[model samples]
Target: MDLKPLLNKLENYHTEKPNRVFTMYLNTDPADPDQQGGEWRLQLKNGLNNFETYLQEDGDSDEKRNYWAVKEKVQHYINENERNLKKSVIIIATADEDIWFAETLQMPVKTEFFWEEQPQLRQLKELQKSFPKTGIILTQKDQVKYIDAELGTVKDTALYELDLDTEDWRQHQGPHRADSNLGSGGAKTSKKDELAERFEANRARWYKSIAPELDQIAKKHHWERIYLVGPSDEVNDLEQHMNKKVEGKINKNLLDHEETKVLNEVV
Candidate 1:
C-alpha cells in the first residue's frame, strides 16, 4: 500500500495539533524473546479520549481486577467511537534478518532462529550496531551496565522484570487472565487457559507500569487516535482486548514495519 500518504497523514495529524500526544512501546529487555526481533526498535502513538481513566483502572493490586478494568475501559472507548476510531492504524517494526528468515522459511519465524545460527557472531554484530561506541562485545552479565552507560538509566524507559511467579501468569495468557473462572476440572481447565493466564499477567504488569506515563502524554497532547505497533499477534490481541472493554473513545490501527514506513511516507 501507499506509505507516503500515511506518513503525510501522521505529519498532518501532529502538525494540526502540536500538543497532540504520541506514545510508543519498546521492549528493552534483551533477554526477552519479544525484544530481540529488531535492531533499533519501533513505537506507536495516537490520540484517545479517557486514556487517563484507563490508566486509573490499571492500578488494581489484584491482577484479575486490573486486567478487567483495563480491558473494560478499552472496550468502552471503542464502542463509543465505532466509526472514527476503527480506522486507526497500528505500526510494527521488524529487522532485515527477521524479514529474510520469514521469506526463507516460507513460514512465520522468530528472531531466536537468527541468534541461534551463530550466537556469538550475531551477538557481536548486533551489539556493535546497537552501540557503535562500544568497542567490545560485553557478556550477558554485563548487559545492564552496558545499557545503562549507552542508553542511560533504564528507569526512564518502560523496562521492568517479568513477574513469572504471579498467579495471573500461571493460569492464563496475558490477554484473558481476568476473565478466567475456575472450573471443577481445575488444572487450569486446559493448557490453553494456562498459557493465556501467563500472557495476561505479563502484559498487565507492563501496561500498569506504563499507564501513568501514557495518561500524562494523552493529557499533554489531547490525542484523538491511537496507533499500536508490535508483533502482529500481540497487537491484534491488544486491540481486541481494548475494544471489548474500553467502549468507543479510541480507534486502533495495526501495521507492520514495512507497512508503517509506507504509511508514514510523509515523514
Candidate 2:
C-alpha cells in the first residue's frame, strides 16, 4: 500500500481551515477494559457517552450534531467491520461531519478521545511497530500445520491442515548385510549413501508439493508476516520455493525448537 499520496493529501487538507479534528480510540471487543466493563453494547454506549461529555464541555455550538453524527458513524463502523470481536476501532474525523479515517485493528487500544492540532498518528505508528496480522506455518518432516496468529493479542487459531506424503520419510532397515556384498564394508557404505540420497530426494519432493499450498494459505489469511518452524534443511528448501509475498515477509525460522513449542516461541 502506497501512503505517500495519502499523507500528502492529509497534509494539504487540514491546512485549508481550522478543521476541528476528533480522534477516538475505541475498544470494540466485547471484553472491554475493566474500567468500562459490561456487555458489548453497554460498553460501547459508555464509551460514546464519555466522548459526548467531553465534546459538550470542550466543543462549541455544533457540538450536539457532532456528537450524534460521530456516535452513529462509529457504532455502524464497529458493527460492520468487526469479525472476531477481538479488534479495536480507531476513527478520526473533522467537525465538518466528514470522516477522515476509520480502521479496525487487531490489537486493543485504550478508549480515549484527543483534540489536537493534527490527527493522532502516534497510535498508528505504535501499531505499525507491532503488526498483528501474522500467520504461523509449523512444518515437520511429514506433517504441516498452518495457524492464523496475531502477534499483539496472542491470538492463535488453527486454520488448515496439510498432511504430506510420509512413506519416504518413515524409517526402515536397509537391505540385510547378507544382501550386500558379503563381508565388504564398502558395500555397506554404498547402501547407506544410497538410502540417504533417496531420503533427501523424497524430502525435496515433499517441499515442492507443500510450498505453494502454504503460500496460498498465507495470502488467503492476509498475513502481513509469516513465521516458519521446521528442520533446517526443510526450512531452507521451503524458503527457496515460497512465493515472493511469503519470502518477503518471512520472520526468522525456529529451527532449534520442536513443532509443539512454536506457540511459545512465537509470542
Candidate 3:
C-alpha cells in the first residue's frame, strides 16, 4: 500500500489527447453521518452523467467513445465490489487500461471525480500523510506480531516466535490467521503457572534477544510509526531493546485476537 511510487506514476501520467483519464474518489462509509442515506450512489450517477453531458456538448466522437468505454468498466467494478466497500474507494484509470490503480481503504475520502488530463491526487496525498505506513507490534511473552499497514489497511504481516530451545527468534511471513499458539509453543496441556514462571524469569533476556530482529523489520518496512501492544511491563522491556522509537503503547495482551480486531484496538 506504499503510495510514493503510485503517486509518481500518476503525477506524470498524461496523453496528447484532450481527455482520456478518469479518476474517482467515493466516500462510501455508511457510518459517516453525511453518507447515512446512501447518497454516494446518487452523487456517482450525477457526476458521471454530468461528464457525459459535457462531452456531448463540446467533445469529439473519438473522445466520447473512449470516455464511455472507461466509464463502463469503472461502473461494473464499483457495482461488483459495492458490498465490500469500506470507508472510501479510489480509482484512477485510462481508456486503454494501461494504468489502473484502485483501492478500498478503511480511511475516509472526499467524494469527488475527475475527467481530466491527469489523475486527481491532492486529496490522495493528504490522506496518505494523515495515515502513513505504520507497524503495529502485538507482543505477549515469547511472541511478537508485526502488521505492515498503510492508510488503515494491512499490507503484510510477520510473526516472530521465540524458539526457546535455540533461544532464537523465528519469523513467519503471511496471513497466519491462527493465534492459538501464542503464549506456548503448542504446549496446550502445560499448566498456566508453569509457563508464566518460565517466561517471567527469562522475559527481559528473551525480549532483549529478539529486539534486533524487530529493528531489522522496522527498517525493512520503513515504518513511519511503531505501536507496541501488550502488558506495560513486557511492552516497556521490548521498547527498551528496540533501536527505533515506539509511537504508542497499549497495555493489553491481545495476541489471541483477530488481526483486524487487534489492529483496531491498537492503532
Candidate 4:
C-alpha cells in the first residue's frame, strides 16, 4: 500500500514506554512453487525470542520491563494482520499503544527487533534505498502491462493485449510515394517516411488507450515514483499522453520489454 505517509507519521511519533519496533521481513509469495509460506509465523516467533535475549543483555531492569510489557500487543497485531501482508511487512509498536503497519512489495530476508528511546527506522531507511515508491509500465505492440512495485514487492496491476486482426499492422502501410519530379529515388524515400509515420500513429493509439488507466492506478495507489519500461519510442509516446499527475511521477524509461528483465532492473 502507501508507506510514505506512514513513514512520515512515524518519524514524529513520541512514546514514553520503551519504543519497541518489530520489523519482520517475510516471503509471502504463495504462487512460488519453491516457497514455504507457512513458516512465517515460526520465523516471527524466533525473531522476537532473539530480541528478548538482546534486550536482556543490553538494557537495565526498568528498560527490560518496559519493553516486555508490550510483547503481547505486538504478537496480537501480527495475528490480526498476518493475512494482509504482501512480500514485506513492517510493524511498529510504541509504549503509548500506538501501532503502525506498512506493507511493501520488497521483502527482506530477516526479522529484526529493536528497542530504543524513540522510533527505530533503520530498517525502513535501508528498505527505501532499495525499494522506492515506484510503479512500472511495461509495453509491447500487441500487449501492455502495468505493474506497481513499492517497498520490496512487485504486482501486476494491469495488462492489455490487442484484440484486433493479426494483420492490422499492415493497414499502417500504404503505396510508396509516387512523386516523380523530386528525384529518381525520392519516391521510395518519401513512401518509407510516410509509412513510418502511419506505424507510429498506430502505436500511439495503443499507448493512449492505456495511459489513463495507468494514471488512475498510480493516483489511487499513491505511487509517487514511476518507471516506464519498454521500447524507447513507445515509452516516450506513452509518457506524452499520460495525465499530469502520472506524468509528474515519471522517473525513468527503460529500453527493455521482457517483464522478468524489467523486474530485475527495478527490483
TM-scores vs. true structure, each candidate: 0.19, 0.50, 0.87, 0.56
Instruction: Please provide, for model 2 over 1-267, each residue's C-alpha lDDT reduced to its tens digit, 9 standing for 90 to 100.
Output: 222344455455552223356677766665555635535556667767876787578666465675567567767777786564555777877656544677665567877766544666666556755764667775544445566654354344442222322332222244212221112234456655665455467767767776777787777666777776666676777777888344222344442343335544564
How high is the lDDT of residue 106 in model 1?
11
lDDT of each: 0.27, 0.57, 0.83, 0.59
Cα RMSD (Å) between model 3 and the true structure?
3.1
Greater-lDDT candidate between 2 and 3:
3
Ranking under TM-score, best-scoring first? 3, 4, 2, 1
CA RMSD, predictions in order: 26.1, 11.1, 3.1, 11.1
Q: After superposition, how far is residue 201 of candidate 2 from its true place, in Å?
A: 3.7
Clash pairs detected, candidate 2: none
CA deviation > 4 Å runs, candidate 1: 1-200, 231-267
lDDT of 3: 0.83
Tens digits of lDDT, candidate 4, 107-197: 5544555555556777777777676766777654444567676665665455555444442211112432222111222345775566445
Q: lDDT (0-100) at residue 250 of candidate 2?
A: 33
